[model samples]
Target: MSWIKTRLKSFGYAFNGLWTLFRTETHAQIHLLALVVVTVAGLITGLERWEWLAIILTIALVVAAEGMNTALEALSDALHPGHHPLVGKAKDVAAGAVLFCAIAALAVALIVFLPHWL
Candidate 1:
């Protein structure tokens, strides 16, 4: 029972963190909108099971990367509290990670949907 309770509490905290990201982050909101659009497109095109799986995984990867970037930025800011070259570099690297994931996801989307569109 105690173990189960601990796991549940961890889940609760995870959900709360997700809520914080969506509530406070503009990038998260944009990603969510893009997710909705992609889901709608996938449904409308009748994506195959494997295609659906790929799309879902790609979306999750991008969002997770964005979340990680946000977390890093927050931590960097909290630790430095002011301009610091190292902190700036850390934040830039985090943002770049998000960008890399977004680009990969976009490429996957194009590969998956271009045929349907054409």
Candidate 2:
């Protein structure tokens, strides 16, 4: 394939993965709802450019963390259909990473929005 075609195919795969994540993952759906709420709040509050950048980056961080966690869980399940302690540990770690990212995202949101509300 040409370089452009290869890049396009890669993007298509990424989009398909994103669709699967949002369609089948409850956590992803919740994140989507949160994203919508944050977007509306930002618009209503009229965020400055830097505030919008922080919000956008934080949202991306959360989504990427969630996606990585889902991917790890799916792979673990497929590789070891039976319960295994190490696999469980790995999955837990991945989930913990997502939780950490989520907490950080919440902090960023509060820092960006609290002043506006106040």
State the C-alpha lDDT per candidate: 0.94, 0.95
Question: Per-residue lDDT for 99 in model 1?
Answer: 94
TM-score per model over all chains = 0.97, 0.97
Query: What is the Å distance of residue 104 in model 2 from its true position?
Result: 0.9
User: Which tens-of-lDDT digit does each residue in 13-105 have in candidate 2?
Assistant: 999999999999999999999999999999999999999999999999999999999999999999999999999999999999999999999
In model 2, which runs have C-alpha deviations exceeding 4 angstroms? Answer: none
lDDT of 1 at 49: 95
True-structure RMSD, every candidate: 0.7, 0.9
As a whole number from 0 to 100, the lDDT of residue 3 in candidate 2 is: 95
Q: Looking at model 2, report the run of 10 residues with the lowest lDDT sum.
A: 94-103
